[model samples]
Target: MDLLRRRAEAVPRGVATAAPIFADRADNAELHDVEGRRFVDFAGGIAVLNVGHRHPRVIAAVADQMARFTHTAFQVVAYEPYVALAERLNGLAPFSGPAKTIFLTTGAEAVENAVKVARAATGRSAVIAFTGGFHGRTAMTSALTGKVYPYKAAFGPMPPEIYHVPFPAPALGVTVEDSLRALAFLFAADVPANRVAAIIIEPVQGEGGFHVAPFALLRELRALCDRHGILLIADEVQSGFARTGRMFGIEHSGVEPDLVTVAKSLAGGFPLSGLIGRAEIMDRVEPGGLGGTYGGSPIACAAALAVLDVIEEEGLIARADAIGERLSARIADYAASNAMAPIANLRGLGAMVGFDILDAAREAPDGLRARQVCARALNEGLILLNCGVQGETIRILVPLTASDAIIDEGLDMLAAALAE
Candidate 1:
C-alpha cells in the first residue's frame, strides 16, 4: 500500500503531520525519504534537533548508556546522569538565586508541573496566560492556551481559573498599553489579582507566530507578579536551549521568571523536558508529587549531556545569532527584490525568525498564500512550517548545525516559493 494510504488507515486524523514523505534517514539538516529523495530540513523537527539529527556525539552517548543498561527507572534506582543533568540545567538558569530542576517526558508535562508547582507554593488556584500563546494540548493547558479552533475546539468543559490577555504586537496594532489594559480589565472583571497563583507566558510566542514579547512589557509583568505575590512562569518550550541566541529567551528581556518550562532541543532528539525554578518554590511540592516513570530516563539524560557539550564545542549559541542575521537579511532582500510578494512584519529573536504573509495590498494577513508557499517549498525539496492562529505566518526552525551553503540553498528555495 502507498505510505499516505497506510497512514490514513492506521493513524487518527486528529494528529497532524506536515510533511507527507516517510523519512528513511536524517542527518545534519537534511532528511532522506523512503523514495530516496533528499530534502533540506528547515523545520528541525519543529525545533527539536538543534544539534541536528543524529549528531555523532549524541549517538555515542545514547549507545554507551544503552550498552550499560537503559532503564532501572530513576525513581526505583537513582542514576548519576539524571542528577548531573539537573545540576547542569540549574546552573545554566538565568536567575541569580538558587534554582532547582525537575525532569519530565514532554513539554506539556513540564508546563503542567509548572502550574502545579505555582499553585502548591502560592496556595492560589488562578492562572493567567497571554492571548495567542500556545502552551500545550492537555485540558488545563488547553484552557491556558490562547488559540482555539484546532487546539481547544471540541475539547471543552476546560479547567477554570485560566484567563488570557493580549500580548504586544506593534505591527498588528496590539500595543503594550493595550496588553496592560486588558490585564487590568481581567483583574477587575474576571479573576482577582490576589487569587492568581501564576502568570505564564512565552517570551517568543511559539505556534502563535514568533511574536517576541517586548522587553519593557516583560519587565512590567515581572513587577506585576512581584506585587501580586504570583509566580511568573516562562513557557520556553519552543525557544529554550540554544535555539535562540541566549540560553533562554527570557534572558533577552533581562527579567527573571519564577519558573521556566523547557523541552524542545533539550535532548537533541531524545524525549526530555525540564522545569527549572527557584529552589524554594520547587521544594513546596511534596515528595512523589512531580515526576513520572519515564521522566529523566538515563538514556535521555545521557543524550542531554552530550547535547550541551555539542553546543559548547560547536559554539552553536553564537552560531544561532549569526544564522538569525543571515536568514533575516536574506529574507528581507528577497522581499525587496520581489515587490509583488506580500511579506511584511518580519521579526524574530535570534535564530527564531518569521514573516507575516499579507494580502497583495498589504492590508490583511493572507493565510491562503502562506499555506501555498509552504506547500510549494515542500515540493521543491525544502521543508518549512507555518504558524499563527490564522496560519498566516511562516517561521524558520532551521537546525543550528546547517552550513552556510545549505542555509543559502534552503532560503533560495523559500524565495522561489514566495514568488510562486
Candidate 2:
C-alpha cells in the first residue's frame, strides 16, 4: 500500500498500470506480489512472453551472452549474433522471394521503420491503416492508430498523410465489404492509391481489441495493393511469435506482405523488434539510412535465438491451439450460464481469445461490468486484462508454456469472478 502510494506520487498517470499489485517474482504462469499474494498470469506481460517467464533456455542464453559481452553497436562494431538472428528471421518471414531485416528496440520503433521503409521504397508519403488498429505509440504510429481516446487523446497533432479505414468485424458491425469500400473511398477522397506507400494491419488487433481480420480481407487487400503498387505492411507486433498458433499471425491469411513490423514476444521479455520485408524493398534505403544504437542488443539476440529453440522444442504452436480450446470452452460455459448471459462475441484466433461483456439484452456494452470482473479476478488470484475501444472486452494472452492445470485453475478463478 505504501509502495502504491509512493508510485502514485512518483509516476505520472499517463504511464498506466492495469493491476494494483506490485510484482515481486514470477514463474511460468504465476506472479507473486510484493505482499506475498500469488496471481495466475494471463497477461503474459502484454504478449511479451509467449514462452513464459524465465524459461531456462532463455535465461541461460542471456546469461551466456552477458558473460561474453553486451553492446558494441552492431553498425559500429559488427557482431555475429545480430547477423545470425536477422538471418533466422529473414528465413522465417513469410514474404515470397528474398527477405531482409532491420532490428529495432521496441514495437513502436519497428512500426515506424516499416512505414519509413515503405515510403522510401515506393516514393510515396501517404500510409493507410485500419480502424481499431494499434501500431505503436510514436508520432507516426499514433497517427496510424484509429483509436482517439487514451492513446491519442491530448497527444496530437499527429504526423501527416496517415489515413484510417475500417477493420472488418461483424460483431462490431463493420464488415469486410465496409472496410474495402472505406479503403476505396480513402483512395478517392484522402490520398491517391498510387501515392499511398503502405497499408499496415494486425491479423488480430491487440490493444484496440482482439478482433481478428478475416482472411478474405487480407487477400482482397493484397490484390488491391498489387493493382496500386502500394506495399502491404502487417503489424504483427502483438500477434506474432506463435501467439496466434502460427510462427507469424499473418501466416493465417496466407497472403504475402511487402513489410512486417514485429515485436512484443520476440525476445522472451528482452527488448528487441524488427522491420522485415522483401529484399528489394528493404534494400531501397542506403547504408546508414537505418540503424539504432540499442536496436538489437547482443543479449536480446541470444535470448531470441533461445526463444526460437524453445518454441520449436516445446511445440508451443500446437500448445497455443490446445490453450485456445480450453479457454474457449470455459468462456462458452460462462456465457451460457444464466448469470453471465448475453456476453456477446467470443472470438479470436488460436489462444488470443477475447469476449465482450454486454449489458442485459446484449444491446449495450458494459465496461463497468468488465472492470468489476477484472478487479474480482485479481482479488481471486488471477491477472486479467480488459481491452476494446469501449473497454468492455476481456482479452486473454496467457503464456503458451503454461500447463493445462494452471490454465484451468486460472479459468476457474475467472468464472468465479464472473459469478460474483
Candidate 3:
C-alpha cells in the first residue's frame, strides 16, 4: 500500500482510482495483494481478463512468442501471427458474410480506426452515437461518449460533427421508440442521415449501467442506416468475447453491424484490440491509413489466439449464460429480502450482470451507496466495480473462467456488504 501510494497514486489524478489492493500476483479468478491477502476478483481488470488472470495457456503462448520475436512492426516486416490472428477475428466477428479485421493496441485505437474506416467507406463526416454510450477515451471516442463526467471532464474540444441521441433505457423510462424518435430528430436538427458516416452503439452498454440495447432498436438502426447509407458500428470493447454469452455482444440481436470495435478481453491480458467489418468497407482505407508500431505485436497475437482456443475448448459461452443466471438470481433474492434499498432495474446478458442501488432513506437510486458497497466488498476480499451515468449501479464482471465456488464467494461478499 505504501509503495502504491508513493509510486502510483501520486502519479496522476487523471488515473482512475480503485480500492488499495496492489495486486502482487494473480491466477485463475483469484488475486493476491501485495500484502499477500487473497481476494476473489469479480472486477476482472474492468472486464479485460475474461479468461481469468495468468491462465497457463495465455502465459505459455505469450512466453513462446516473446522468445521468437517481440516487435517487428507488422507493416515494416509482417509476421505470421498477425495474419493468423486477423484471420481468426475475421471469422469470429458477428457477420456470417466475408469480413476483414485490423488490429490495434487498445480499445480506443480500435474505435478511432473504426471511425476512420466508416468515413473512408461512406465519404461522410458526421457520426451518430447514443447517450450513456462509452466507446473509448480518444479524441473521437470521447466525442462519441455521452456521459460527461470522468470520461469527458477536462478533456475539452472534442472532434467535430459527432452527434449524440438518447439511447433506450427502460429502467430510466426511455423507451426504444423514444430513442429512435430522438435519432430522427437528430437527423433533422443536427446532421442529416445521409451526412452521417456511422451510428455506433454498445449492444450492452458497459459504463452506462449494462443496459442492453433492445433488439427492436438495433433492427430499426440497421434499417435506418441502410436507407441512408450510414454504417452501424458496434463498440463491443467491454461486452465482447463471451462476456455476454456469445463471441460478440451484437450476437444477442440478429442485427449485423457494418463495423465492430472489440478489445478488453481480446488477448486475455495482452494489449490488443481490433476493428472488424465488411471486407469492402475495411479495404477502403489505404495501406498506410491504419496500423501502429505495436498494433499487432506477435506476442499479443499469440496470446489472443490462445484466448480463442480457451474460449472454445472451455465452452465459455455456455458458462457465461449459466453464470449470469446464477448471479442474477442471487441479486434478485438479495433485493427481495432487503426492502430498505431494493435493487431495481436488474439488467444484463450472460455473465455481465448489474443492478441499481436504491437510496437507504427514500428507496430511490443512490450512487454514493453503490460506491460504498463496492468499497466494502473490496475490504471484505471481493473486487467489485461501479458503473452507470450516475454511478448508482454495481456491475459484476467476473471472468467466465471463474469456478462456481469463487462466484458464490464473491456473491456472499456482496450480500454481506448490502446487509451492512
| Alpha-carbon local distance difference test for all models | 0.92, 0.90, 0.90
Q: lDDT rank, highest first?
A: 1, 2, 3
On lDDT, the stronger of 1 and 3 is 1
lDDT (tens digit, per residue) of candidate 1 on 1-420:
399999999999999998888999999999999999999999999999899999999999999999998988777899999999999999999788999999999999999999999999999999999989998899988888899978887975889888899888966689999999999999999999999999999999989999999999999999999998999999999998887898899999899999999998999999999999999999999999988999998999999999999999999999999999999999888767655468888999889999989888878998888988999999989999999978899999999999999999999889888884
Model 2 scores a C-alpha lDDT of 0.90
Pairwise lDDT winner, candidates 1 and 2: 1
TM-score of each: 0.98, 0.98, 0.98
* Model 1 TM-score on a 0 to 1 scale: 0.98
Clashes of 2: 0
lDDT of 1 at 383: 96
* Of 2 and 3, the candidate ranking higher by lDDT: 2
Deviation from truth (RMSD, Å), model 1: 1.0
Query: Which residue pairs overlap in candidate 2's backbone?
Result: none
Candidate 2 local lDDT, 326-364, one digit each (tens) = 999989989888876357799998999999998877788
lDDT of 2 at 130: 87
Worst 10-residue lDDT window for candidate 1 reads 333-342
lDDT for predicted candidate 3 compared with the true structure: 0.90
Off by more than 4 A, model 1: none
How much is 88 displaced in model 2, in angstroms? 1.0
